[model samples]
Target: MMKIVADENIPLLHNFFSDIGPIETFPGRELNAQNVGDADILLVRSVTNVDEGLLKNSNVKFVGTCTIGMDHIDTEYLQQNNIAFASAPGCNATSVVEYVVSALSSLTESNGLNLEKIRVGVVGCGNVGSRVVETLKRLGIDVCCNDPLIDQTGLVSFDEILSCDVITLHTPLTKDGPYPTHHMFNDEVLSRLKEEQILINTGRGAVVDGRALKHKLQKQPSFTAVLDVWESEPAIDIELANLVTIGTPHIAGYSLDGKVAGTEMIYQAMCRHFGLPSRHKAAQFIPSPPLSKLYFTSEAELSWSMHTAIRACYDVRHDHYALMSSLSGTEVQRSQAFDQLRKSYRPRREFSTIKVLLKNTDSSMHSQFKALGFNVKSA
Candidate 1:
């Protein structure tokens, strides 16, 4: 059997790759050359930094990250060493989209704001942002999209995005190149935000300056912020976490479906690299969700019913609560707790997993629910 070293948090690894390999699991951050020395396959998440130093002495012929972002992986080193690398792009996109929707529903409900009335600005129009734009428009939300890489007609400028009622970021973290996203939202951009405007960051933490955000929240009381990914993640800024309206430990793309999809993506890639027949599928390992279906009453309001169904499958508040409880120790302890929380995160199902049966609802209502990614059916 092939020798494989993989990150421990990657779900269903053995189920997918066991027939081909003997897998040894390690914490992503702690996965060093020593752990990968004798392995022909190395799999990791965004936490592990793949570089020459780590792989120069190892037998790792293939490297894969089960996450969308590639900033953590050194593609140059892999190219130079002839080590094949694969990353699961858009694997967890729907999960992130659902996270934003849940946060939107939860935030709007708490703040007494109407979802359809608000204009949301999505910074990146890639896999995740595109889905967000489509979903929001399905709900009749006014949306503005900005992507430096893509030149589409509907794309708006970043300045235009600044004026939106809610700004959701989905850009990747890049330091070099023409369009750098590191510290994209500094004091100047943050100062432009209004007191009541909502800011949600599920893209990357450093995309918005943490210190600047903290200062902004401190000086401006009512400026609402929702953060899932932080700048110096694991070792995140606790003060900033406390200031945000909702804080989750980089789990926006952590739905069980998403993670499994990611694993399957890389598994297929590895199989292709080795010229092996792919025998396993992700759906085979996935079972029915705990929340199978939801019933709507004749008296249920459209918006209220939508929010109820969304929250029943996923509530950002639950993640926020879990994260808040882990924030009580020293910086080191808190940092460790943050990573632990992500590793042992509860299995969250996607919006599509929950079946919504509508009663006495219009066609538009059913269509909207489907657009929002729920498995909707007329009762």
Candidate 2:
């Protein structure tokens, strides 16, 4: 029988594939070759680096990642090591896009920010950014795009992105490229931003300089920010987290449907490559309880309803802000603060988790969510 070892973060794998082979589960950090010993196939998330260091003397022949991003995997190394690897791409694009749009709608309503006339710029028009652009355009918003790699395939320039009313980044963390985004938005670049514009980054964390953003936030007074990913991950900049309009612990792609889809893709890939039968099934997604009838029908009511819904799922901004505010004096203490909060973060409901509830105002809205595979129920 083939030996298989899977990362703990991957859900519902054992029950789906237990009869396929002898399987073992370990924490992501414990997936290094030394720990897994003689496993023939290794399944991972983005956490376990599948580089030479972790697999030098291992017997692992096949590697599969349950994630959209392959930046964590060393493709060149895997190719040289004769390791066949696969990743589930575009699986969580819709999930993440929905998260960004819903969050934006909530932020604007709560903070009274106007989106009607706002010029939105999206960087890196890949799976996630492309969906975001399409959805925003569907909502009748002005949108621009920037991606040099895609520019070779007929994309716009970054200079045009700088002029937008709101900028949202979705590029990968590349340090050396024609359009290197590692620390791309630093102090000098940030100085060029308009005073009233908003900035949102749901992509990689290091793409934006947190310290520089804090400096800009102080100097540029009128600017606002929404960060879902932070530099150094669980060890984020406390002061910057407190100042942003909305912040979250990189859970933008954590929708229930997305997770299941991503895992199923990987499972199917494994079965196909090994000539095993696929038994993956579509999971039944259910939405949250309906909200009480609105007392007043203002933007305030809509804002409050959205806030309650979002908070009911998970409120990363308020909770992280509170964590940082209550930190002890030392930098080490603050670092520990972020780690504790992140490690202890409760499960958040992704867009798929909330059954689609159309407020009866728009028949189009009902159709929209249904098209996106949501279980729509109109009030």
Candidate 3:
């Protein structure tokens, strides 16, 4: 029998991968060589760092992270050691997109900004950014995209990206490259942002210089910042958190539907790595959301109705509150609570799980809702 070691936070590990071996679970950040020494397989989320220090003496032959970003893992080392590795790309793309929609709804509702009227600038047109562009356009919001790697029409320059009414980041964190994303939005970049513009970063914390962001926000109270990810997380910048319009622990992609999809993706890869039959699927283990279908009355205005429906499915404020409430005490305590927030994050279902029942809404709304990833029908 194979020996497996996995992160305790990975949902449905036993249901999906138990047949392969007996599994041991540990906190992802605390996983050390002693814990994984004899294991043949290791599974993780983004928190665990799979490098030589932890796996140097281990019998672990296969490694997997159930996350879209692989910045935590040392891939070159894995290749040098002949260890097979896999990451679930685009697994939580929809979850992140829905999180954006919910955040946008909150902004539009509170700030009296018309969703259809404002332009949204999306930096990095990867899995999440591309989906964001598609969804925003579906809602009739003008979208400007920027990704240097891809050749596409209508891709905006970095300067144009700064001019949008709302700018959302979805790029991966990179330190060294021709276009390293590390601190892409630094003091100089943050200074150029309009005071009335909205800046949201769900992609990576280091993508924006947190200190610069804090100074900018302090200088301009009207500049709205909605941060889902942060620099030096768990022990995040307290002053910055206190200053931002909305800040939360990185749970944007922690929706139950997305988490399970990540588990299943790595499971399939593990099965292939070990030459075992891949019999399990993600849908088998998913449960229904509390509100399966939500109906909007005919009197419901388009923007208000859309915001109401989206928030009803997944409200971003609760997440913001959860993080703000938990962040207190010493640095270590705040860090621990940050991890705890992620571990005990309230179960969030993706928009695809709930059907939006539109009545009194324009027939065009059906395609719009569908474009936003919700199953829609006439009520």
Candidate 4:
């Protein structure tokens, strides 16, 4: 039997891959050369650093990460050593999009601002960003997109995106290249943000300079910031955490559906690489959602009904409060708490899992709900 090493935090590992081989589990951050030395396959999340240091003496032939981002893995080294690797791209795109919508709903409600009147600027047009743009547009919300790499006509400039009512980032972290994103929002760019503008980052933490952001928030105080990712994460700045409107341990993509989908994607890849018959599917492994159905009457306001339904499925405030309450000790303690929150994250299903029953609703509203990935039923 083949030996497999996997991150303990990854969901549905045993259910899907246990039939293939005996799987050894470890905390992603604690995975080292010694622990993975004799394994034939290694599976991990973003917390593990997969490099030559960890695999130099290992017999690991295949590596996979059940996460969207790949910054934690050294692809160059893996390629040089003839190790096959795979990452689940776009698996969590819907989850992140739902997070942005939930945050915006809470932000607008608290501030007494009209959602339709706000212009949202999406900074990256990849898998996650494109979904955000599509969802916002379907709701009659104005959205401007900025992605230099994509060749779509009428792409907005970066400067135009900066001046929008809300700015959300979904770009990867790149430090040294033609279009580097590391510190993309430096002091100069951050200074340009108006008091009315709200900034939300669900992308990589280092994309924005954390120290600069903290200092700017200290001076401005009126600038609204919603941060799900931070620089030097796990040890993220406490002051910045306090300053942000909504702060969360990096778990925007922790939805049970998304995590299971990621695992399934990588599992199929591994099975194909080894020419084994793949027998697992994500839908079969997903458990019943906490909120399975919501009913809306004819008198229900479209915006209110939508907001209530989305929040019912997964509310962002629960996570925000959890992070705020966890960071009450020394830096190391806070760091441990941050990781613990992620490890013990509760099961959250996506919009599609919940069915919305609408009475006397128009075709437009029904179409909108369907477009947002909701199961819509007319009564």
lDDT of 1: 0.92
Q: Residue-wise lDDT of candidate 3 within 223-321, one digit each (tens)?
A: 999999999876799999998888889999999988998999999998888889999987787777888988876777766666777888889999899
**Which regions of candidate 3 fall more than 4 Å away from where they truly are?**
none
Candidate 1 on 1-379: residue-level lDDT in tens? 7899999999999999899879999988899889899999999998898998789888889999999999888899999899999999999999999999999989877787788689999999999999899988988899989998997898988999999999999999999999999999999999999998999999988999999999999998678999999988889988988988899999999999999999999999999999999999998999889999999867888878888888889999999999999989798999899999998998899988888898888888888888988888888
Say which prediction, candidate 2 or candidate 4, comes out ahead on TM-score. 4
Residue 185 CA error for candidate 2 (Å)? 1.4
- Greater-TM-score candidate between 1 and 2: 1
Full-model lDDT, candidate 3: 0.90
How well is each residue in 1-379 modelled by candidate 2, as lDDT tens digits? 7888888666667766677789888767557667656887888876678898887888888889988888789989999989888898887787677666666666576567676768889988988898888877776678878887774544667888988888889988888867788999998889899877788888888899888999998776568788878887556777777777777666677665566677788888888888888875646332342432222122234435444554544444554355656456676776656555544544444544456454534555444444443455765
User: Candidate 4: worst 10 consecutive residues by lDDT?
Assistant: 107-116
lDDT of 4: 0.91
Clashes of each: 0, 1, 0, 0
Task: Point out where model 2 deviates above 4 Å.
Answer: 151-154, 282-347, 352-379
- Tell me the alpha-carbon RMSD of every candidate: 1.0, 4.0, 1.2, 1.0
Error of 3 at 207 (Å): 0.6
Per-candidate TM-score against the hidden true structure: 0.98, 0.83, 0.97, 0.98
* Residue 209 Cα positional deviation in candidate 1, in Å, after optimal superposition: 0.9
**By the lDDT metric, which is better: model 1 or model 2?**
1
